[model samples]
Every structure is written in structure tokens, then in C-alpha cells.
Target: MTDDLLLTGARVLDPGGGRSGRYDVAVRGGRIAAVGADLPHRDARHVVDLRGKLLTPGLVDLHTHVYAGATYWGIHPDPVAWYSGVTTWVDAGSAGAYSIEAFRRAIRDFRVRVPVLLNISAVGLTGRTGESRDLENCDVDLAVATVADNRDLVAGIKVRVDRETVGRHGTEPLRRGVEVAAACGLPVMVHIGTTPPRLADVLALLRPGDIVTHCASAIAAAADGGGPVSPALREAHAAGVLLDIGHGSGGFAFDVLEAQLAAGLTPYSVSSDLHARCLYGPAFDLPTTMAKLLAVGLTLDEVVAAATVRPARALRLPDGIGTLTPGAPADLAVFTVEDGPFELVDAHRQRRYAPRRLVNDATYVAGRLLPPRLPEPPRPWIPLTAAQRQALQRRAGTVRALLTAPLVGPEGLAEQFPRQQAAVPLDPAAAVREPVADPVSEEG
Candidate 1:
């Protein structure tokens, strides 16, 4: 194929500059040749019209599981990546030291850019059981050796810190993981859920550049007393800890996310923790997760930054990978922002209607056009099973009584649902303040 290709008449969205306007982007020798209005058509060997579409840098999903044949939770990367406008997919702790070689062998032929976070546990996500439950699986020396051996492929270390995964180990596993990360000179991506170590303790062990995935989880007794954004979380963010939306099954809660957004604790990166269970619903793909964020309150530019530029920076990938500037890699995605009365559901099954949602139109990787996948029929919300419905009915009875009682305003909200009120911003601008220095520049 010829090296020259041109995309004309599209609204180019540059999240880095916070700008969007009609322009043409030229590609040659697998890099952006030029981006401007009305470049001479004669300079291009081939051209495609993208009228009425939005073009931006190809997306990067920092947290995903694409070790496919090697791990239990793995899913193939290409189907979810290129088709959904993602050119780079970072596998989050799907394969540990023991299985990483096999994982590497399996993905040798894949076209998408795949970097991995080595799991702290040697076995990784081998089975249904938690990788860290045994503690012995967390072999630090072995992890260091593996990272040293696979420097090019391994971006960081990953550890899941939760009640089910780490159990009574509390913060011990996290400390061990952090040690290994320090030894290898890499960052650690910690998965947070219902905690025994408590979110504060986990944050304490983490250095400035480390990542906290699933920051919006709504399981019982969250870090900030079940509030959307906790004071400790704000402190962690201020201290330079990066938060990610690892929207996995049971990870994202609409109520929790809304409160966090309102409080100004926006995520540093947006990723779909796309695994076997979540790939079909809730967290369908990176674009779907981006759409959910847009539905909540983020502008299109903000959402694109979370998916593209921010992720590339967080992963410490080369600078040009997530930008559309001249001489950068010609990885681009086109999307259509459709008006919607669309029902968007979170991990908790709480539903919201969005007036607009983003849909993928086309994708280009390395200046080569990739075939688009047929759109999956929309399945907004999963059907509630009988047992779940029955339980909800019981809870509804309790809520019904409260609703019938005299309604109070803000005080009543704070009294009945203190977590939500606690998440509300006291100073809206301060709550949503940007970090003083770029968190992406810090070393692990």
C-alpha cells in the first residue's frame, strides 16, 4: 500500500489543546504529514472524506486483560481494540512471571500495541481464586527478575488489594508489590475493592506515580465511609497518586461516579478493565467507558484526553503515540456523537438516561485503514435475575417508608445518604483543581 493517505473535512478534536474544528489530516511514511485546512489534494495519493465526524488521536486503554489463551480472565485484544478505536491496549496484571512467557508467545502476531503490568503474584489470574490469597504466590525476587528480563514489554507491576483477593493479608501484599516495583524501577497499578487494608493504608504505601484502579468502586465500607470522594482520596490525588476508571464488573457505580465528578475528583485515565465477565455488559469496550463518562458530565474534549493523551502519559509510552501533531504516529479514530435518550448502566445496575453518546465510526492504525467490525446490537442494561429482583423489592419497602416521611432538603440528603453529601464539593473549583505538576512525569 502507498504511504500517502488523507482524511478530509472532519472536525479534528485535539484534547491536548482543547480545540475542535474542521480540518484535514495528512499521513505519509506511517506518521502525520500535516494537519490543516485545505491542503493540496494533489499531494495525497489517496483520500477519504470524513464529513460530519470527529477525528482524534487513537485511544489508549491503560487497564485491560488481553492475555487471551494464557489467563482465565483474558480476552482477545484486536476485536476490542482496533474495532473500538483503540490502537494501544495495556494488559493490567493478567499474566504474572510464571505465565508471561506464554502470554507473550500468544500475542506475537497481534497488530495492536500491547504493554503489560506484571502481576505481583507469580501465578497471576490463573483460576477463580485470588492470586494474592496464598501470599507465597507473591514472589518479589522472581517478579524483579521477570521485569528485568522483559523490560521492553513490562511497563509496571500490578496487585489486587481487596477483601476477597488479599483476605487477611491486609496491606502486606501491597507493600510487597510496591517493593518489587521499586526494585524494577516501574510503577505499580493497585486494584482496590472492598478493603481490609482500607484505601488509606493502600494509598500510604503507594508512591506518587503509582496507579489506583477501580477508584470509584461502591462496595461496602469504601475508603471514605462509602462516600463517592473521600478526604483521603483527595489527599492521595494531591500527593500525586493517579486514579483510573477501571470499569470492570462490580467496579463502577453511577452514584459513586456522579459524586466524585461533582466533587472534582476526576479520573486521570479512562480504561475498560475488559475481561471475560465485563466485556459483554457494563464495560463493553474503551469507547463505551468513554461514552459513560461523557454521559455523566465530562465534555468530549475531556473524555478524549482521559482515553488518549492521559493514558499514554501515565504508561510512560513514547510522547508522540497519543498525539496528532505532525510527525507523530498516524493512529487516528473517527467517532459519531449521536443524540440519545440512551440508557447507560453502571456496575451496580443503577441507570441514567443520556442525551448524547459516542459511537465508533472508523479507525486507522499506522496509516493503514482497518476494517470496521459490525456494531453489536445495543443491550443497555442487563436483565435482573429473580433473586436480585426479590432482594431489591425488600430494600424498596424500606426506602418507600423514608420517601413517604417528611422530605427535607440538603440536610435530609446528608442525613439519609451521608456518603453522597460528603462527596459534594465545598468549593467547586478547588474540588476540581488540576494537579500542580504532571503526575505522569513522576518516576515509579
Candidate 2:
């Protein structure tokens, strides 16, 4: 008897259909066999009722750094996957040629499905900023050799040319990185924040199928308070270059993003640069980031597509890791349509506070259901531990001070309504300082 499970009475939210309704889905041999209102359960194994929950396809986080031990920026992937319901994640340039094997044998081999983008820098992002300046580390031959050696695990190449980071090497390093990746016939994923030469110049190097992450990020001269995305960006997009939202710590700029969105530029894929420094706040998890987009005018279907099928297509994963269609892996996520007052931020220091945030209920991967735990009850008012007492005293003092003080201007309040603050006079000088400026265009 084949062991199987049935999930029924749930409102399925399918990206392909963009609709929600009661449905039944069946899982057998770690794959979804059927989905509808009534699925046969004769000679079955187990059945679970899913009432009042929204069922969606399992999420795929495309731009993550899961180097584990190779780099400080790398993080263990399983916790983010199982806990957060991400079944497929693409490691956005964590390890280089020298250290990729260890990553494959120790990490990728153990996990289910985690493809990697080999960093163009031969040594990868080790130590700190200038570590990339070491010429030997960025050996093109070594990177090509490594990618050729591990064709099964490596997806493409990654390069960073941030202004404060890559320094003088600039376009030369990027050109070399592309050369190695081109030899291997894989797309290149470039991290654009502080790179030299210029954003337009770097963007000009990317060809169709190649990826440009942090398209709305506040890069070297691409800061929100700067200027507009160079004509090169528009041309690249027109030429089929995929733009990814690598919403990491210093990647997404709210101001630049607003401008880009208003300019009619939309991202092809939405991904979180999920890592230690980024996973906590604005980029809590892929789902949260998707919810933020939903708040920012992306339809539910558009948001889901960017995070799932669109990314799966970009990665060229023919097995179909994005949809919930029959014969696909039984990966799914269940959430509640929560009404919440939430706050979101971008690479720029701007904040978007919304009245709602998606709250996860349960997640399923390969027929295994992992439900989120209920929040723990507050501790009884007992003698506090040293750490707890210190926290409580600080909170108490802050609250008492707030209570005693008179309500001043809107600036004094933590979360004041927009109407409370007086608008500042528009300044022509500020316009000149728009963070994101005209990026370098190989043309000029």
C-alpha cells in the first residue's frame, strides 16, 4: 500500500490562476497527484482537514547567501527553509572556486535542493571589503576551472563592484568575471551597490539571460537621493536582462525604488538577499518581502509569480520548482490573511508602515507539514532574572518618562500620523543631490 496524505477544505491561492477557493490536494511519494474539491481517499493512509487557511505553492528564495562556513555573510539554509517555508533557494555568490567543493560536499549534498552562484572573485567574499583586491583571488582561469569541475551544482557567476568595495579594479574585474562565466555558458548575477566605473557602465556588460540584482538598490551613485537609472538600464531591460530585487541591508533604496516604479520599470523577479545582517528586519523572510510588495501595488499573483515561477524560469530549473500543478513536488505554504499595522523599509532610510502583514500558519515540503508554533505565554510577574530585570527597568523608565511628558510636536511621538507633521518647503538644492545619479554609460 502506497502511503499518502490528503489536505482538504482549504482556500487554495494559486499564482497561475490568481484565485482562492475551497479545494482538496493529495500527496503521494512526495509529489502532488491531484487537486480539486473532492479527491478519492479509498485505500488511503492519512487525511488532514485544513479549514480557514490559505494554501499557496511552496516559496522559492532566489537571492540568498548560504555559504555556511566559507564566508561570514553566508548563513545555514535549513533554518530559513524549513522554518520559513522556503523549499528552493539560490545561493547568490557565496563561495568561489577555491572553496566551492566544501560547500557542495558538506552543505548542498546534505540539503534537498540549493543551487549556487559561484562568485567571480576566485576567493569569494572572505574577510572584509578590500579582500577582493588580492589579484590571485580573482583568477579568471581558476573560476572557470571550478565552474567546469562542478557543472551540476553551480548555476552561474557572481561579482560585486560596490564603490566602497571593489575599488580601482572596477569594470576590469567585472569583465574578467563575465569572461570566465561565458566560457562555462552560464548567466552572470551581478551585485550592484557601490561598484566603480558606474551602474550604467556595469549594466551595459550584462547580456540577455544574465541577471542584475538590486535594480532598485542604493548603489555607489545609485542612491535614492541621487538621480535616475541610466539609459543603459532601460536598454538592458529592453534587451531581456532580468532585474532582481535583492532587498538586502544596503541593496534596496526606497527613494530610488519609488522613482523607478514611477518610471514604469518593474522587476522580473523578487528575491531577498537573505543572510545574517538582512534576515531580521526589512527582509525578515521571502514571504514578508512579498507582502511588502503587495502593499506597494503588486497584485497577489504578480507578487507570487516574481517569487516563484519567474525565478524558477530564470534559473532554468526544468523540473518546475514553482507551481502547484499535478505531478510536481508536494511543496506548499498555508497563511492567514492577517489585518496588521506593519512597517517596511527600503535600501534608502525610508519607511512604509502598512495596516497589514502576512502571518504564517503552516508550511509543507515534500508531503511533510511543519506548523508554526503558537507564541509562548508571557512569563508570570515573578522575580525577574538579571537580564529580564535590566530590560524591564529600561522599558519602565522609558514608559514613565513618556507618560509624564506633555504631547509635543509630531517629531516627539514614535509613530505619529502623517497629518501631524508640517510639510517642509521644497528645495531646489535637495533635488540636485538626488542619491541615484546618472550611472556610468560605456557610451560616454
**Model 2 whole-model lDDT (C-alpha atoms):** 0.73
Question: Which 10 consecutive positions of candidate 2 have the poorest summed lDDT?
Answer: 374-383
The sequence of per-residue lDDT tens digits that candidate 2 reaches over residues 344-405 is 77655577754555566666778887543322222232223476557657766886798788
TM-score of each: 0.81, 0.78
The numbered model that scores best in lDDT is 1
Candidate 1 residues 1-444, lDDT tens each? 343998999999977534579889999998988889997788889988989998999998999888765566777777666568898889999898898888888778777788899999999987644789888899888889999899989999999998888878988888999999999778899998876777878888888988989888887326447476776788888888998999988788878878888888889999899877677677878888887887788887888999888888787887478889888889899888788868888997888776677678888888887664322221224344466557657756776787797887766564555554545448877878986876677753
In model 1, which runs have C-alpha deviations exceeding 4 angstroms?
1-3, 17-19, 220-226, 372-444
Residue 241's lDDT within candidate 1 is: 91
Over all chains combined, what TM-score does candidate 2 have? 0.78
Instruction: Give Cα distance to truth, residue 386, candidate 1, Å.
Output: 11
